[model samples]
Target: MEKSNQLFNQEQQIIHRLLLNAPFIPSVGLLTGQVGIALAFYTYYRHTECAVYGDFAGELLDNALESLDKSIDIAFSNGLTGIGWGIEYLILKGFVDGCGVEICENIDQKIMESDPRRISDLSLEQGLEGLIHYVLIHISASIKQNVRLPFDSLYLKDLYTVVKQACQEDIPDSFRSLAEIYMDFIEKQEPIDYPLHLFSFIDIVHLDTDKLTDYPLGIKDGLAGLLLKEITNE
Candidate 1:
């Protein structure tokens, strides 16, 4: 994980420019990528104790929403469920709360309003199912992260039902089956099964082992693998 200051500086400049207008526009991809990178760097620090990546990840997340002063809400240019993944990370990592939590909650509401059947693109990153996959990932994350019985025993369960119905009839029941497992884990009804179901979660998110480090965000690296990494890190 060692690197020259030049590489750090280059990454800084690139992310900085992309982040400047992030909060003001509907840049879900960009904003989510920023958060994913931060999580990767932070997780790298957590796993390997690398201060450089940790600090860089922190700074990246800290300055991510600079335009919040201009806009109160995180605007979405189109229908997307993965949009809230960044805010969820911010809260999970203790980066933002108060107004940040409010903003994050608003993002959830927007996601609920999104068309469960409308996947905007075919890329593994932004497709309807990909977004839904992430929604499942993040929803599972939220369930695991909660202190008060994990959002009252179910996080994003409603959204799961909405999108699940839109899927093909032959979709595997691992995720939703795990949904019950999730509830049980949160409710202490079947807590032992939660850990068992987690390994199966890889199927739900469609993780590609080879692409785990391909980038800082989107499907392969940030939003998916790193996200799962954080969950397992617990």
Candidate 2:
């Protein structure tokens, strides 16, 4: 826990530095959210199923560096202007270490600010990184893959429904105003996904932790109760 907190702080500092040096280019930085979602998924998967999550983080950090190289190559091939890859390795580190959602939303905001015509255009070629695309393609993927909302929190049910509806609905100004709704939904939904390993480390919440200690922890018993309660309410 101490180590994770330390790493989290370090990532925050790194992301701050990169944001300071970040360029004001358009459309190119959209991949930041996509990459963040991938990282979040992997993070949860590590805690739940993988024994080598730490090693995986190290390897992924290295891959983020390599991804910068690829981004540069992509930028050079296309006519996109600004930094070789507007998305930086430090930002990627922050995302993997638990800062991705915030960072991605920040980037998505940049996308919206850069192109105001996207809502009317509704064309990808027109550079529509507004709220809806951000929510559905980038943000939702991260929340669903990493946070395990449906698995944990009830408030998350309403939150996801709202965002999912915004993405699926044909609202005017979805790029700007509609996107705001999506952001609000995400903000409310975060608590559901947060404390990534909160329940997993407890016998009452996650029995696996107790199982490791050879204690008779009724992890499933509690989960069954919770599940029953949820079903009954439905």
Candidate 3:
């Protein structure tokens, strides 16, 4: 168990460093697309290696999956929205798909059985609010890090303006209010409490269990085909 934990932590650190230092190409979608592909391949290799080796392999693979799932939860809880959200989703889905549904499902069920808090019953509205807070936190971090903004230069400003205008036109005030808070944080360079603030808005639970269970049929074959073609051409 100690060895497994060490391995899991090391892998996570490597992934996080890559995600943080990846060059910004001025397109969130493109950046995340590249990241998603790389992450999927890395995850597939790790999962397959463990699956091929029987003995204590199942336990090790389960640890790996659980660690990955927890990382995804932390990302979402920290306001990982937009392209980052999609990338993490693809990484999780692709890894599970590569691992085979039966194995993945058995692990997931075991996780849920052990931790009741692993699933949530939050409303969509509440979830959206959590997402908003997360976005705001990331925007503030971007400003501090001086990384190129993921969206258009004026995207955040434009969103604030549009929301304010909507308020004047008698549209719902909730979103506009949230927008105002985000704008303030961006302008003031205030630090966000991140995962702490995240928990205030949403419970710490995996919300998309059913989606995770499905495994995007044939994805493993698609990945295998690409690998085989590369080998043949090489």
Candidate 4:
């Protein structure tokens, strides 16, 4: 066996051992939702330019991404629709270390401000899944529009810039007016009645955060955003 193969085998063995004993280990970052640690490993993968290091770091990157993806999949399967609170919990537990009180509070504020449930004072969010199914039939009938409501908490707040840009030309002014009305109805501090345009709402809530901030976290917004983009295209 050559030196490189021997080293590979050794490292692989160590990884297997760590994975088997992961629950007992204190620093298995993915298990604990410490994505910063995962990102650190990813940096090593991307920046490893050493001739001697070769494919080792690349392999590690694959594992890191796969591990993170699996964790996401497992969480999704077990009803992890939104990761906002989880991230905040990380911040509080000092897992998101170094971001102090002010930054954490800002992050917390952003999360609460954007959620439709928060903005609507829990009114709009109630029966959201059932509401989607019920209204899909009628809206599709009256306007012939096939509505794909944004994912849980994927709000217009998340896609604020998208809305603002879409409303810039105001071909009929309805789009812009609709945007304003929705904002006014769902005022963060004091929500009024449920907006007539309910599907315009989202759980992840419409994604104005596309440019405003980083609420949906990474590609956390996922493919549901494709529908949002397509609608904005009109």
lDDT of each: 0.42, 0.32, 0.34, 0.30
Candidate 4 structure quality by residue, lDDT tens digits, 1-234: 555534334223333332233223222222222232222223223344443222432333234333333233212111121122223233333334423233223322333243333221111122122222222222222222232222223443444434444445533343444454444533452232222331232223343422422332211231222222333444
After superposition, the stretches of candidate 3 with alpha carbons farther than 4 Å from their true spots are: 1-131, 166-177, 185-196, 203-234
User: Rank order by TM-score, top first?
Assistant: 1, 3, 2, 4
By TM-score, how accurate is candidate 1?
A: 0.45
Candidate 1 ranges beyond 4 A from true positions: 1-32, 47-50, 67-83, 86-103, 117-124, 127-168, 172-234
The better candidate by lDDT, 2 or 3, is 3
Q: Rank candidates by lDDT, best first.
A: 1, 3, 2, 4
Tell me, by TM-score, which candidate is best: 1
TM-score of each candidate structure, all chains considered together: 0.45, 0.27, 0.29, 0.20
Query: How far does residue 140 in candidate 4 sit from its true spot (Å)?
Result: 34
Native-referenced Cα lDDT, model 4: 0.30
When 1 and 4 are scored with TM-score, the better candidate is 1
**What lDDT does model 3 reach?**
0.34
Clashes of each: 1, 1, 1, 22
Q: Candidate 2's residue-wise lDDT over 85-195, tens digit each?
A: 212222333433443344334333333333232133342223332223333433344554474222123333443454454456564552445355445656664322111
lDDT of residue 56 for candidate 3: 30
Model 1 CA RMSD to the hidden true structure, in angstroms: 9.0
